[model samples]
Target: MMIANLTGMRSFLILGFPGLSPKHYGPVSALLFFIYLAIAIENIFILTFVIFEKSLQKPTYLVFCHLALNDLTFGTLTLPRIISKYWFGDSIISFYGCFTQMFFVHYLGSVTSFMLLVMTLDRFIAICIPLRYPVLMTNNIISVLCGFAWFIPLPLVVAIVLHALTLPFCKSNIIAQCYCDHISITSQACGENVKIVQVTTLCMAMVCLLLPLAFIVFSYISILVVILKMSNAAGRKRTLSTCTPQIFITCLFYLPRCFVYVSNTVGFSFSLDVRIFLILWYSLLPAAVNPIIYCFKTQAIKEMLKKRLRKTKIGIKIQLSY
Candidate 1:
């Protein structure tokens, strides 16, 4: 078996939206730039609000803070390169760089998946086992769960990334998508071992993506049963309200992924441009809308933003008078 030397540098070109017309580049780049900016600012606001507000430091809010951080990191890792690809025409990345990007892209995704699961558990306890929720989801326990969500995916993703790095990439170095990902990069490797990469990728998807999705579905079903048992209309309404945002976010994250995975597993084909667009849509859309969903749906966050805006207005008035 031939081994690729890790010491030598290899680079890959990220082809963003193949056959994109030069005329549409400016509008597309501008739109993406604003979207990236919105994601950054919105997530930062969520993190800051959760951290500084004493009333918002419950287990639920802590999870939101972690999610905001995850979105910020995911957006930061992905958008800049693609933005530059469209704006400045800089898309080539070094071999190690590609691996690094690929690792975090999947790693953070796995973390987000688990975080959503953790959030589901939080909601389940609060709604289904209200009497025991305080004991079950104590501050210490929530902290531990948060740590697990962030760190548990590390070893699994590391193993996969190392395996991909060792594969000989003697084929075309041009990636069809705007970012480096496990499947896109692995597809370019030249050898029978490529089949191993494909199988492993599929297994990783099942483990990292499907498992969390299953747990989320189960958690929601349990919550629904509990809610239905509640005879008090107000109580039932409150419980459903608390759950709505999470359900929306979870569906946003998982549905597109499920589609992509099933399509690949069944050998369902899509045009290259369509595939790239879907990948970009799922990856970026969730990050962009997550904070917005929370802000609009969660009363606590909405009130906090209202107070902050009022304070800003008062400060502006004082400055104008001066």
Candidate 2:
């Protein structure tokens, strides 16, 4: 029944949107579809690299691994389903299946948001109190942080799923996006999603997003104050150089999130295409962009990638020699 609901709604969009018409946006759509394919591929390599490589076992790399995994899940939550609409044309999904997608969409998002906060805290301890870095971010503590990242969102998702089971089907089931996002469900909402909006916004933006951003702000501020007081000019410069990339990456995540929170609250009544397009821009683009930023922005990740490439070539040569 849930699958039927999801399928019927997706079929409606494929049939109704006339989005494929080759007039204005066709080229743009085609370009985005291809870009998403590359995003999917890059994230796959990143995830695999993080998972199988013992060299990436440091605290910083551990966070990167989790980020890569979240990126894979984040992209999967929407892109595959969207790609299917174009490639397969309106696939069927059970009601429970829709719940599953919705759950993951929330799940990955909640985790990513929390991960950003923890990443900030990790950086905070490392930079501000360098003497205690080892004792501060222990593996046992990180496991607890990881647990909080995931465990916090379950109740909200369970609520959404339970809500889905109760929503009456009239001729009212129209999903405007390529996939079912929470906002789309709210647009078709038959019951209490006002709280969903408030709580989810609070969780996603305030607790997870804004709080970390604030920490990033304060952490960097504190770091700068310390740098100013440092007697060794060379030490201060080195610290700033190392800190610059992390700060830039924080901006990349935070700026867009600010926009998303405002847009979601203000533009709830806009046309379906407009609303969904905005949501997709916020949700999907960040996940794809983060790895690129990490590679380009952070010296450590760049060096790691280069080191891995060298190892790959060495392995290839050995294989050929045998």
- The candidate maximizing lDDT is 1
TM-score of 2: 0.78
What is candidate 1's local distance difference test score? Answer: 0.88
Q: Please report, in order, the local distance difference test score of every candidate based on alpha carbons.
A: 0.88, 0.65
lDDT of 2 by residue, 66-135 (tens): 7777877777666766666555555454445665777787667767777776777777788789899899
TM-score of each: 0.93, 0.78
**lDDT score, candidate 2:** 0.65
Residue 47 in candidate 1, Cα distance off native in Å: 0.5
Could you report the Cα RMSD, in angstroms, for every candidate shown? 3.0, 4.5
Residue 215 of model 1, lDDT score: 90
